[model samples]
Target: MNNKAFEVLQKEAPEVSEVWQQFLLKASALDEKTQNLVYLSVLSAFHLENRIPFHVKMAKMHGATRDEVISAVLVGLPALGNIVTTALSVAIEAFDKD
Candidate 1:
């Protein structure tokens, strides 16, 4: 929520941000938990550490268990290798948070 780039985009190009939000809303065909799981996997694969916590929390809110969050992070290991480990701790910490 404190992402500066996103904040700047919303401030400077509100229309573009609105469109992106619309796209996300329309494009999310999967159930909320599944979508969050897919998103967590992508974030892990890409090593997007900064974004992981938010999505992990979202995933948990959508009924993802801590073990499911861990599995989601590790799901990319076969394809991408140990690089995904960088996100494992962050995701777990976020999911464990109350």
Candidate 2:
């Protein structure tokens, strides 16, 4: 039988699973919209993860403007530097959607 995504994650790494749950709880402590914007910023960090589109959509749903999301991504550029930050261009492409 195919396990659900959550189940697979739990089995794969129980420690990570706990941290994930805790992260979600903290994110959810904010308003739904703010939470979504935060998630979008995170996904923007992992361009190849294929999670960018979903989180960008969620960010929009949460009332974040394109500028806000882009700014958030840009905020990481200093710390992540060019090499890592450039990878997040995929998020800009994703955000270009209608």
lDDT accuracy of residue 59 in candidate 1: 83
Model 1, residue 39: what's the lDDT?
Answer: 85
Kindly list the per-residue Cα lDDT of model 1 for residues 1-98, writing each as its tens digit. 44688889999999999999778867888887888888889988987889988888888888999999999999999989999999999998898787
Worst 10 residues of 2 by lDDT: 40-49
**Model 2 whole-model lDDT (C-alpha atoms):** 0.66
Among these predicted structures, which one has the highest TM-score?
1
Which parts of model 2 are misplaced by more than 4 Å? 1-27, 47-49
Cα lDDT tens digits for candidate 2, 1-98? 12366678889889998998688767576876677666665655554336666667767777878887777666656666664465356666777786
Query: What's the CA error at residue 64 for candidate 2, in Å?
Result: 0.9
lDDT (Cα, 0-100) at 41 in candidate 1: 93
Separate clash counts for every candidate: 0, 0
TM-score for every candidate vs. truth?
A: 0.81, 0.59
